[model samples]
Target chain A: MSKKVKIVAATGCPTGIAHTFMAEEALKRAAEKLGVEIKVETHGQVGVQNQLTKEEIRAADGVIVAADKDVDAGRFKGKPTVDVSVSAGIKEAEHLIQQIIDGKARPYKGNSNAESKQEESSEGKSAGGFGRAIYKHLMNGVSHMLPFVVGGGVLIALSFLFGIHSANPDHESYNEFAAFLNSTGGVAFGLMVPILAAFIGQSIAQRPGMVAGFVGGMMANTGGAGFLGGIVAGFIAGYIILLLMKLLKGLPRTLDGLKAIFLYPLFGIFLTGAAMYFVVEPMTTINEAMMSFLSNFQDANPILLGLIVGSMSALDMGGPVNKAAYLTGTALLSDGNFFFMAGVSAACITPPLITAFATVFFRKFFNEQERNAGLVNFILGSTHITEGAIPFAAKNPIVVIPILMVGSSISAILTYIFSVQVPAPHGGFLVLPVVTNGVLWVVAILIGSLVGGFIYGMYQKYSYQKTK
Target chain B: MELLNKNLIKMHTNFQTQEEVFEGIASLAVEQGLASDKKTVVAGLANREKESTTGFFDGFAIPHTKNSAIQKAGIVIMVNESGLEWNSMDGQPAKFFISLLIPENEAGTTHLTLLAAVSRMLVHEDIRAKLLTLENEEKIYEEIKRFLSENM
Candidate 1:
């Protein structure tokens, strides 16, 4: 991993409370905005929380001492330093961060006296490692993108209530409200890629990076590279802007104002746009391949997906394995792929419904307790609660779970083959109104249950006869 | 430590000078059991002020100090209707005072986090604007406390 540019800061106020912390927060915010690494030592009422070490001081490219009280800065000699009042640290934090980034600050002209012994205390090393940092940046993008997705997706889904083709205007089911919702939703949805890229860029390199990220993301979208490409564009834009800033650091101080408003953004966007053009080409191919693979789970090989989903749903029903499959389906649903979730929902609905069917089919084989529980499963199955099947499985898990798996598999496979598209993630049969081929989906579930119910009922009858 | 409270917050006071403001803050700190006496608190605040003015932007001053006289870390907020003569960074007469007192032996106590949170809060324009608009001392104390809890 590329190491971040590190800066060391010391903050203190006479009372050692308000100003010290304010300056630290201000510096940290500024450094984060600029995508630089910083370690701040605070001299406060509770004393110093110094994780700053000799190695850190030696490694840091710049030093910032923002204090009203003496923090003993003589140790930072020969390092480029910004020496300022605690108030200035808070008020002019960004400027100081910018100065550090530009490497424009003069080296502190102080003697290094190791003998003076500024307390070398180090502990509580922050665990914000590189992987977590990257995740944080990605989360910043993901979080902002979700709002647009929900707003657009729900409105679009509502348009489907009028009919899937209602937005086409010439369609018979077209209504004015549906058409309006569809188009408005489409417009908002179109911004998802740009917003994702822009926020990621903001996380990586603040304002200039955001500009580049937006433009790059637009290019990625127009190129048909999709959301993954948008992510690539964001990182590229952020890094490119950082690279640009470094390259232009040699410019005269008089041109600083012009560089900010005119030069940096113009050059930054142009470079990121040019870079994304090359990036999007390869990404388009990768994106197309991934999309095809995903759609294949819908268009072909329903049985393979069915077995996997069905088995996982039945294996320790409502356990981690089941949750894993459910989460995967939900994640894909968020990506606007509903087929996996459709199969997953079918699989989950099957096991409980099978047990309900078994009780009715072999009424003589079941006790009163079993009959009552089976009746409850009817309601649970309809609501897509797979855990309702657990009681029956727990009775004879070795035998019963396999039967449940087979029933779930058949339901999932049939749903996929029949092209039943469930727009909503949950609500089971309750979401049937929004589901395409809704009745066929129920028929598919019923067929699986009927077959599995017969086998399960026969087994119970045989066991009951043997016991008698 | 619980940094600020209703007793420490006095709204719409008509202080006319910086010295009187310091005296008022010292008395409040003494009453709150944060400081041993008013004189040491006033002296600490004055001595720190002589080093550099704590007067900040838009008629707000955060006068703070640490001394042997203080028994704890605490804050006193005084919102005066009349402005006092303070050699502030903005050259504006100060009307709002957020005073801080820290005991000399308060090292490693958790009060620093609370104090630092208050110190950092002064930079936000919205909070500063809201502070001047608040009508009651309890509301002001609550607002500051709420902000501190969120930050700390």
Candidate 2:
């Protein structure tokens, strides 16, 4: 009889929540069902548990990296590695495992091997598998962005609760409160873009790549690139760092050690910033025209605008795409235009409100735990929290999507009718104190959300009745 | 015990309180032989509520009971126009409610089927919008049926 082959695996996602564990379980189950013995490692938010040691890696026939975020591929320098997203790990784990067993997998040696002999390169690692790694790092940055979103939003809600809706850019009391809020909340918000860039960079170039990415992100934001620019800057930083790391591969031990940490970051940041500022800026500016076009769209197409904004709000929940729409609308805040932001803020809370209220009104439809979760979702929605919908949307997209669209559209219409305008490019209740018609904006949102929730509940009720 | 039946979706509902919502679904359960009495059904479902909330992810909630309050199995679907306020993990309001009353032993893969169907359809934005726009009981049923058939 032929000897059995053994392999080690790791599974993780950017969120490090359900998908991470789910993939791990799937892979384990698949291996067991296939009559194979496998060792799996998981790096999650609670930290790495059930980790595979060097011995396990060395003994395994091959490694499977099923992750959405960056997993260190350096360790398995010469081992046959099959890299896939966490979703694939969960859905196609057996197939992936089998592929690895058949020796169809490729080896991935960090950037160190990129400059090695061409003859040995085919046996070396590939660099093109960094897309998934970059996505993972981006999610890390977003995970860290939540605190800022909540804190800033709540503070602004408090400002509104205090009835301090200031419109002037030069008021003392308003500025002081704004300063306090900025100090408390803005710092975290400010970190969003840089952190995004840093992690994206880190994914490609490892720990040493963070500084360059962060600096590049800062430059992008300062140069009007915002988060999107930060993303571009991050890739540039990462690739530059990786190239430099490759170039410095054959240096002496001491110099090489210092070069990876200090020299690479220094040069990488300067090069990335210079490149983005000079090369990327002009190219991206062309896209900014799209933003400008959206901003100045006054063709009396309220329905079109509503649909666009509604879709954009739900498309990414709170990612960069969502932020783009939000920022475009809020950018008018400085010019005393709050209508755009009011629409966005309204669109923001409607999904959660509808979900929460539907559970409360129709207890028969929800299981005990889901109804309870609805309450928390509603609270988050009221505060303009959007990520709260992620778990639900992730679990059931069809039901959530329609619910989101209906709720968002209703809110968007209400905001338009209320003429609520926001000046800032990105904020929820955090921008309330600085928004036009803050109280009216909130009222409009509440009313629209009520309508949306009611409609959704009715629809669910009808659908259930017919299903029986 | 199926708490949700085809008639869960009523053309016009007059629910003014939690009891009304419970009664609406409980009657269906009683008729389907899932529950012997409305009060007992309410109590049993309410008891389950003490254990945990029923807000499932993906914009639908399946409030159910396998406990003693139910004598028969039935399902009741409810859709609100302004939507009810429930705490969801996503911090959003729920628009659809799939109330299910299943017999302790009889509620096997059916529940999973329903959950999976809802999850699958919810993932599609266009189909979901069509569901929300659906007004007639037959149309809603067709949508659910299609979703289940395709997904299952």
- The sequence of per-residue lDDT tens digits that candidate 1 reaches over residues A252-341 is 656767866887689989998888889767644553453444445544487887777777666645444565567667778888877788
Chain B TM-scores per candidate, in order, are: 0.95, 0.72
Which candidate should be chosen as best, given TM-score against the real structure? Answer: 2
- Model 2 ranges with Cα > 4 A deviation: A1-135, A165-179, A243-255, A278-410, A417-468, B1-152
- What TM value does the first chain of each candidate achieve? 0.47, 0.53
**Candidate 1 Cα errors over 4 Å, as ranges:** A1-128, A161-163, A282-301, A305-414, A417-468, B1-152
The single-chain TM-score for chain B of candidate 1 is 0.95
Worst 10 residues of 2 chain A by lDDT: A113-122
Residue B120 accuracy (lDDT) in model 2: 33
Candidate 1 chain B weakest lDDT stretch, 10 residues: B107-116
On a 0 to 100 scale, what is the lDDT of residue A296 in model 1?
52
Residue B51 displacement in candidate 1 (angstroms): 33
Alpha-carbon deviation at A288 in model 1, angstroms: 6.0
Question: Each model's number of backbone clashes?
Answer: 2, 116
